[model samples]
Structure formats: C-alpha cells, structure tokens
Target: MDRQEDRHRLDLRLALADLVADTAACVRFFSRLPVPKLCSADDPARLPDFSQISRAIPLAGIVVAMPAGLLVLLLGLSQLPTLASGFLVVGMLAMVTGALHEDGLADVADGFFGGHTPERRLEIMKDSRIGAFGSIALIVSLGLKAVLIAALLDRYTPLEAMVILLGAESLGRTLIVWQWSTLPAARPDGLAHRFGVPISKTFKQACIFGAACLLPTLPVLPLPSLALGLILAPLAAHGVGMLAKARIGGFSGDVLGAVQQVGTLVFLAGCLAVA
Candidate 1:
C-alpha cells in the first residue's frame, strides 16, 4: 500500500509538470499565454498572476516562429521551379505567428506618431480601428520583408536564404528577451510586466539559445557579415529600448512586439543592403 501511494504521488507530480510545460510551451509560441479557467479574468485574485503569464507568450512566439521560417525556406527550395510557392510559404509562416506583433507595430506607429500626449497616444493604440498611419506602416513593413526575401531568393541559393531568415528571427526574439530584462513596465499593470518580471537567467542558457540561433547562420554569410549581424542584435535592442523608454516611460506589450518586428526587419534590411 505504501509503495502504491508513493507511485501515485510521483505520477501526480509528473502530470503537474506536463501541465506547467504546456503553459510554458504556449508562452514560447504565442508570447501571450492564456490563463486557465482556474484563474478566470473575472476573479480579481487571479489578475496579478495571470497578467505575468500573458506577457510571456511572445517569448514562446519567437521560439516556435523561427523554425517555421526555416521550414518555409526548405519547402521553397525543394520546389525551386515554383518560386511563387516560396512567397506563399513565407506568408503562411507569418500567419502562423498570428501577426500579433505586426498588429502592435502598426498600432504603435499610428498612436505614437498621431498623438501629441501620452494619454492620447495610449487611447489611440487601444482603439480597435486602424488608422491611416497604421495601414501604411503595415503595408510598408510587410512589403519590405517580402521584397527583400524575394530578392534574396532570386540571387542566393536556398540554403543561404534559409540561414538568414532563421538567424534574423532568432536574433529578433532574443532582442525581445534582452529588452524585457532591462526595461521597466510602462504601466502598473500591463502585459509586458510578465516578461519584465526579473528572473535570473544563467549564462549557459543564453549561450545554448544563442548558439542554436547563430550556428546555422555562420555558414551562410562570410565571417565579416556574420559578425555584423551579431553586433547589430545588441545595437538594435538598445535603440528600441531607448525609443520605448522615451515614448511610454517604459516598455509595454506593444513595445515588445514592435521591437521584435522592427528588429527582424532591420536585420533583413541590413543583410540586403550589404549583400
């Protein structure tokens, strides 16, 4: 009876681990983890904790999205004769990310650029209606990415483009992590705080994730260009951090999403300009 009880306890522990892992897995993909019914939105007691979980979703988004980009490159190359398919593959991958960050990017552009005060800016961002600025920003950002990727496809071999896309996505998400670590939450209770909640990350974990992202990229470009990409990662993060601080007095979910989207685009633009 004692042995059976011990085994049952262990099984319960394992099940709990699986559940938490599911939550973390969702965070890794969505960058906004959803709260379970146990912590319903209506329950004020759950609000504080649920808020943190929600913000971690974008981190997960980066983790999952990078591989999707690589898959697109692989499939596109496999069907090289059908070049149009490559564009569709990439577009589909973007959709998989739910375009959460892209939407935030457009909203931020519209709100920040259109409004003169912080209150007005935040209000504009909160509005569901997209404005002229948001629409234009979205079109330009997406168009630039498509154009740049297509051009690279036309010129470079499949392997080279795949590496770049993967590297950019990983590096861009890493920037979000970096930004989250350094900045204060813009509001007393906003989505970004969950990620910004300071936790000690080990150097080993950093290197492991960094190596996973950068190693594949090393073979694509020359040593010098690879170095440039590495250098730009920190620089871009810092630039966005400054902008975010200046705008909202700190970072929010929108700012984090904007950082990832802008950082990825900036890296891609750099790759194209140099090549």
Candidate 2:
C-alpha cells in the first residue's frame, strides 16, 4: 500500500499549500513585504488565485503599515514635533506602497473632474501626466491626512497612536477590496481590470479578515474610534464608488486607489475624534 500512502500524502500537501499561498499572494500584491515565492517560471499561468488572495488584504495592511507606524512612534518618543512625525509616517507609507493609492487618487481626480464624458474620463485616467485637478486633489487629501495624524499624536500616547495607525491601514485596505468586489471595471484593460473584480463571497471574507486584523487593538482603541472607523470607512468607499460608477461608468484601478486614500482620511478622522 506504499503507492496508496504516497497518493494520500500528495493530496494533504496540496491542501496545506493553499493556506500559505493565499496570504502570501495578497501581501505580495499589495505591499513590498517579502512574502512566499509566488511566481512560477515553469508555468506562467499557474499564478496565485487573486480571488482567494483578496481575503487577506487587511492582513497585508498590518504587515505593510507596521514600519511606518513604528517610525512615527520612535519619532514621537524622540520629542519631534507632531507635524514632523506625521509627515514622516505619511512618507513611509508612500514609499512602502510605492504610492499606488496616491497615484490612483490623482488619476481619478483628473479623469472624473477633467473629462466631459465617460469615455473621455477613462482615457484621461489612463494618462500618466497629472493635471490641475489631480494636483489639487492630492494636495488636499494628503494635507488632511497629515494634519489628522498629527492630531492623533497630540491626543493619545505613542502606543495608542500606533494602534490607530494600524486600525486605519487595515480599514482603508478593506474598503479597496469592498469596492472592487461590488463595482464593475470601468475599462476593458488596465491594472484594475487585470486584477478582475472580486465576487460577493470574497468581499465578505475580506471584511471579516479586516475586522480580525484590528482585534489586537480593540481593548485600547477608544470605543468611539472603533465604531466610527467601521462606519466611516465603508461610507467613504460607497460614496466614492457611487461617484465613480456615475462619472466613469464604473470603478478603475485609480478609483480603487482614490477610495483607499479617501477612506483612510475619513477612517482616521472618525477614530481621532473619540481618541
């Protein structure tokens, strides 16, 4: 029965393989974290299942944002001005994520506000060049985030500040997944289209995963912060999604990025309010 045992063993190994691959795939896709090897030269099509991997986006957020939060914490401990610490934290996030969300925000602003029609809007979004609308929107969005993060530093202990940062990161990314799951891709091809839309099942799992990622800080985070983050983040996502659907015909990669940027601000504001 050695052959039978070998077949059973192979089945178990295949089953166990998915547990790690799914999480690694999300982390690899969203951040610069050194996740498990995902690419297969042997078979290019044998890639990680992004549909399943979407469920781990929030968990990936924790991995991605930790360094930025820790840097801010250390800066605060060193008696740096709150503004500088906030600025550094924002910089860290941009550097780590390659400013993908920020890029998305600018593109969405340029496309949605600059274009006269849906077709024109999608074309504008695809352009790499930033315009006046994008310039203004990025400045406004980033400025608000920096100011609010500074407010958090002023209102709470360094440890709590880190917790708040983590919560915001997790919540912001969850919104991206939620938006992607619900909205149709606005264009025939692009980053967002290549990624494809997540199904309802994936969306629900992502929400649960995002919430679970915040569990460590639940005891220390202000009750109001918790409540507000939940409410505000989704509202931000839904509002932006609705706007994209109406303006551009549906969501694009840029729309996903824009929502994450916007959702982070609202989520942080809500949490900072009760902090």
Candidate 3:
C-alpha cells in the first residue's frame, strides 16, 4: 500500500508539471511575452506543439489578457472616460500580442478580397505590404472592439468589465483552436500546415478547458447574456470557417486569426446587447 501511494503521488506531480509546461508553451506561442522555457527537452526557437499545448490555450488566453484587464480596472477606478479607457486597453492588448491577430485579420481581408483566385490570394497574403482592404479592416475591427468595450465599461463595474474582457479573450483563443482542429491546411507550406491540425481529442480538451475559463464570468454577467454570447461566438467562428472553405479551400494561420477576431467581436456584442 505504501508503494502504491508513492506511485500515485508521483503521477499527480508529473501531471501537474506537464500542465504548467503546456500552459507556458501556449503563452509563449500566443503572445510576445518572454516566458521561460518550462520543459528543457522542448526547443525554445521552434513553434510549440499546438496538438498538446492546445489544452491550455484558454488558460493562456486569460494569462495573455490579464495585463490589459488589469489596465481596464485601473482606468475605471481612475474615473477615466470609458471611450478613452477602452482604446487604451485595446492598444495595450495589441501591444501585448504584438498585434498578431490584427495582422492576420488584415492579411485575410486583403487576400480574400483583393485577388480573383486562390493562388493570387495566397501570394497577396504572403506579401508584407498592407493595402486598402487590409487598412480598412484593421480600422473597423479595432474601432468596433474599442467601442464595444467602452459600452461594457459604461454599464458594468470595473471588476465585471475586467472579467468580461478575460472571458472574451479566452473564448477568442478557444475558437482559434477549434478552427485549427476542424479545418485542413489551405496551403502545403503554410504555418498552419507546418503546425499540423490538432486531433479531435485535443480539440475536445480545449473546449472543456475553455469552458472552465469562462466560469469566472458567471457571477458578473447575466445568465441569459452569457448563454447568448456563448452560443453566438462559436457560430461566428463557424461562419469564418465557411468563408475560408469557400475562399481558399481550407484554413491557414491568417484564417485562424480571423476566426479569433470575429468570434471575440460576436461574443462581446452579444453580451453587450443585453447588458
């Protein structure tokens, strides 16, 4: 019995360590944060194994957004104007993430609309220059997010608004994982293809973890609004998936980013509607 108990304890310790490592990997991948390498065997320069780290993506999302959320709380307590605070928090988030999703959204907009064929679209996406479509897309998405965040702040308390921001961020990253898992890579040599599609088990684990991350908002948000947001967010992501399927034949890294942006917007909008 003593030996069995010791082995069980060892197992639990190893599992906890692995979970921490995975979450760190995800944080490193998703944000520009200089998180230390937790697992020595894993290469620091290479892309994280999304298949394994995906289970912690939701938690990583919360971790990534924590700084911006804290900023919101601070600004709210300072009695800053809601609109200005909203823009500042949004800017902070963009800085934290190195504007990764925003860049992807811009690329997707430019590529999907600028070219007549998939080949040309892919070429356009690979180009570093931002065009008219990309510029317009960045303005609209960022503007909408700031406005919606301001609206939420105007209605809810600082703490509640912070929770809502965290929930939105978590849900957005969860949708990215979902789209990455469900859709095939659109290009053979693209980042999405190289990263590899996550298996069903990984996706299911992500959903479970993502749901757990959202639980904090239960007390802050109205139940009906929460449910509406939950239902609409995934649908918005699915619409992005469908558009990707039709436009480029499958998903790419840009598509995943687009998924995150659109899903987040829908979730926040739904919540704000009834708040």
Candidate 4:
C-alpha cells in the first residue's frame, strides 16, 4: 500500500507538471507575452507541439486577455464612455496579441477576394503588403467588434463585462483549435502545416477543456445569452470553414486567424443580444 501511494503521488505530480508546461507553450504561441520556460525540458528555440499543447489553448486565451479584461474593468469603474472604453480594450488586445488574428483576417480577405486563381490567392495571402480588400476588412471587423463590446459594457456591470470578455477570448481560441483539428492545411509549406493537424483525441480533450473555461461565466451571465453565444460562435466558425473550403480547398494559418476573429465577434454579439 505504501509503494502504491507513492507511485500515485508521482503520477499526479507529473500530470501537474505537464499541464503547466502545456499552458505555457500555448501562451507563448498565441501571444507575445514573455513567459519564462516552465519546464526544464522545453527548448526555447523550438515551436510548441500543437497536438499536445492545443488542449491548453483556451486557458492560454484567458491569460492572454487578462490584461485587457483588467483594463476594461478599470475603465468601467472610472465611468469612461462605453464606446471609448470598448475601443481602448480592443486596441489593448491587438497590442497584446500583436494583432496576430487581425493580420490573418486581412490576409484572408485580400487573398479570397482579390485573386481569381488559387495560386494567385495563395500568393496574395503570402504578401506582406495590405491591399484594398485587406484594409477594408480590418476596418469593418475592428469597428464592429468595438461596437459590440461597447454595447456589452453599457448593459452589464464591470465584473460581468470582464467575465464576458474572458469567455469570448477563450471561446474564440476554442474555435481556432476546432478548425485546426477539422481542416487540413491549405498549403504544403506554411506554419499551419508545420504545426500539423491534431489527432482526434487531442481535439476532443481540447473541446472539453475549452468548455470548462466558460463555466466561470455561468454565474455572471444569463443562461439564454450564454447558450446563444455558445451556439452562434461555433456556427460562425463553421461558416468560415465552409468559405475557406470553397475558396482554397482547406484552411491556412490566416484562415484559422480569421475564424478566431469571426468567432469572437459572433459570441459577443450573441451574448449582448440577449443580455
């Protein structure tokens, strides 16, 4: 019995260590945050293994958005104009993630609309320059998100607003993982392809973890709003997936980014509509 107890404790410790390491890997991958290496075995130069680390992506999303959420809470307490506070929080989020998803939205817009051929579209997406379609896409998405967030702030208390923000961030990332798991990489050589599609078990675990992350908001948000947000967010992601399939045959990194942006917006919208 003594030996069995010792082995069980060892197993629990190892699992805890792995959980910390995976969360750290996801934070490093998704944001520009300066997270120190949590595990001795982690290589600083190596990319995270998404197949494993993807399970922690939703948790990482909360960590990534925590600063912005705090900022919104402060602004709310200060009685700042709702619209202005919304824009500020959105801007802070962009800075936090280095506008990573926004850039992808722009790239997808440019590629999908500007180029007639798949080869040309892929080329356009790879281009560093932003075209007219890309510019317009960025403007519309950013403006819409700001408006929706402002509406939420105007309707709810600061604490509730913070929960909503965290929920949106995590749900958006869950959608990203969903797409990464379900769709094949559009290009043979790109970051998405290199990360590789997660196995079925990893995807299921990620969904479970992602759902767990949203539980905190249940007490703060209405049941109908939360349910609507959950439903609509995944539907929006599905629409994006269908569009990507029709245009490029599969998803690229940019497509995944687009999915996140769209998913986040739809989730917020659904929540606000019934809140």
lDDT per residue (tens digit) for residues 1-275 in model 4: 99999999989888877877888888888889998877764555677888777888888899999999998889889868899998999999999999999999999999999999888899999999999999999999999888987887888888888888998999999898898888877888876657767777877877888888898889888999889999999999999998888888789989989999999999999987874
> What TM-score would every model get versus the actual structure?
0.73, 0.88, 0.96, 0.96
Off by over 4 Å in 1: 1-63, 78-90, 193-208
Positional deviation of 21 in candidate 2, in angstroms? 2.0
lDDT per residue for candidate 3 within 167-256, as digits (tens), equals 999999999989888887889987665665677888898889898989989999998899899999999999999888888888898888
Residue 198, model 3, lDDT: 74
TM-score ranking of the models: 4, 3, 2, 1
Model 3 per-residue lDDT at 242: 87
**Number of the top candidate by lDDT?**
3
**Cα-based lDDT for every prediction:** 0.64, 0.81, 0.89, 0.88
Clashes per candidate, residues 3 or more apart or on different chains: 10, 0, 0, 0
The TM-score that candidate 3 achieves is 0.96
Ranking by lDDT: 3, 4, 2, 1
Model 2 CA lDDT for position 200: 79
- TM-score for candidate 2: 0.88
